[model samples]
Target: MRNDEVLVKVEGVSKKFCKSLKRSLWYGAGDISRSVLGLKNPEKLRKDEFWAVKDVSFEVRRGECLGLIGHNGAGKSTLLKMLNGLIRPDEGRIEMKGKVGALIELGAGFNPVLTGRENVYNNGAVLGFSKAEIDRKFDEIVAFAEMEEFIDTPVQNYSSGMKVRLGFAVASQMEPDVLIIDEVLAVGDLGFKIKCFNEIYRLIENAAVILVSHSMPQVAQVCRTGLVLKQGKINFGPGKVSNAIINYFGIFENNGLNIEGNRRGEIRNFKFGNNDTSVELDISKNQNQPEIILENCQNVFFETSVIIEPSVENFSLIISITDIDQKVVAQVTPPERMFTNLTKMMVVEAKVNSLMLNTGNYSISVHIYNKSNAVDRGEILIGIRNILKFTVKKQKFVGAAPILYESRWKEC
Candidate 1:
């Protein structure tokens, strides 16, 4: 809470894990034995052990947010656990300057048998607040979580989304000097996510935060500094999280095209273009780019060019719009088209009339399906996830199901 404090400092940190569960347990026993005996080479890896995090280091000062991003098993979760003190780094040092609040795993510290309200108080107390202090902020936390009706329910009966809401509510409202949140934001609905983000923005005024999310836009929205971990090493340094995002997505080799893997066709190019307007998207950039902002209630033009070889006969384009939280907004695509040509370039276009989505960034995935002659069924050939992305803004807070449906006044 002091001015210009260094809330978290990680130095040459590394952690290792065993591939097999039984070996992992054995490794843990060996580690404890070595520690008790003050043995040397304790950090050395065993035959079954692999480095989850290796020589990674970073510092977060007051009023700063650090972003951690990588593919699954790239040591993101391991680094977060080390930062939260849930797991110790096999080597190097981690220093915490003040009270730390971490929302690491989903419902990590909650007592399943206790009621949600009771868990709130318990968490608040653990964060160093008195009973009277928790009492003063309890209503605000419950209201922010929108769990007023279910606050008294046992956590065992609560859904995963409910647990996320309550966990985020308590952590964000606890006023910790250091805040660390993993990918828990994906569980809550859009409304709660927006509220949670607002709270994070407010909390960073005098605190330091570390956030990890697969969605680049979400990380760019909250954090100014970033790190890209690749195979247990820090591939990118802090500062300019946008560049870090490009680097993370750029890891998709072969020009970001999935042509070889079990597929009936190849996506030559995917872009957003409107013939009537000058709004043309260069597909070479990262998905959900900053240059593709569009106004709501306007037509969204999408074009995907595909090439199918002789083996596969018929195919169609199935495009899906997914928001930053990885929620499927709509499977908006062009009318069905059956093409029988082989090694021919075919362009598929979709015109979404009056885009009803609320203000946020969305990614478009191009999925090609082929009707297999052997099975007489439509099988997914090639799926290019998050091929393109765009931002939408200048809208009020609306409920889920972003599209606006056609309506007319009728007598009931």
Candidate 2:
């Protein structure tokens, strides 16, 4: 098929499962009997049955990669299994054009007793390759997996990472017209994961790819379009990957301010804002964490007052910014000299000029540390994680970087 051709198409597909295993077996037998008798099975949910994937529809062209993202148990894997033909949807139709390669689960198609070399050929044959074709691609697959020395080992003996490397190598090297990858890549080491992403980029040039992952960065890096599933239904997209990522993060509620440290200090008041906006907190109400919205390149300022015990002599204030994954993206630390004078009560403030974070949700963490103890050591007098949350909005979604630096450009 041509590059623009639609290789995978789904129309309102839905799948349901029974919660009880015994009931599930009974229902399966009844469905089989009805099928043999040429009677249509019921479409509605029965007792203890629930839809795993509901009314999902989308199409993938030959040169496109669709990022399917969601929280755990959001039916992402169920939809992928349906698309890969491992299972059938109960309610809709699916059309897949050409050879479909999948690494949906670790060691999914391999026989544990078989050697890696034997399983490679077995998988190639399952993908409709003949002996000659498998022979031509065999060496390349082994080298890509870096399993040349372990090719003769049984797959059961291979580590999880080894299985992931071998499985990804076979699925990608075959050059199938459609590739479906689940979260199996998370098992491999970072180096191999990078190699897999590079291969995925090359594959999507002429093939239709469907990637299901919880890693938003991975989805943003490789996918042109995205779909977010929530509770077996579409929560967002068949739209921009960035918006889908934002919607995915929106599924979880933000945590309240969590303070941890020695009792030497207590935060009395905290507030923050940008040049165009400011937020004041009322700690007496015991309210949920406050959220602030800011435009791109806005200046951010934060101020807090802390009451220290008499024994505490000097302390330094540290502010850290974290993304939705709770990964620290940016941090601000003042010079130690700023806190030399001893005081029982003090107000500290910090400012960030022209904040350049990408469009996403971020949280602030405040730390008060004794100046004499090293920052690396556990010398925190007081610390609050998720003390405040903020979102940066932009007109257009740029590439997924924690910081979108405004670099000066010139032609030489």
Tens-digit lDDT track of model 2 for 31-150: 999999999999888999999999999999999999999989999999999988889899999999999999999889999999999999999999999999999999999999999999
* lDDT winner: 2
Q: Candidate 2: how large is its RMSD?
A: 2.7
- The true-versus-predicted C-alpha distance at residue 40 of model 2, in Å, is 1.8
Candidate 1 regions with alpha-carbon error over 4 angstroms:
1-3, 255-412
Tell me the lDDT of model 2 at 296: 46
- Every candidate's CA RMSD: 8.8, 2.7
RMSD of 1: 8.8
Candidate 1 residue-wise lDDT, 41-135, digit = tens? 45567788899999998889899999999898899988989888788888999999777888998998899999999999999988889999999
Stretches of candidate 2 off by over 4 Å are 288-291, 296-299, 338-345, 356-360, 372-377, 393-400, 404-412
**Candidate 2: residue 52 lDDT (0-100):** 96
Task: Name the lDDT value of residue 1 in candidate 2.
Answer: 57
TM-score of 1: 0.66
So what's the TM-score on candidate 2?
Answer: 0.89
Alpha-carbon deviation at 300 in model 1, angstroms: 20
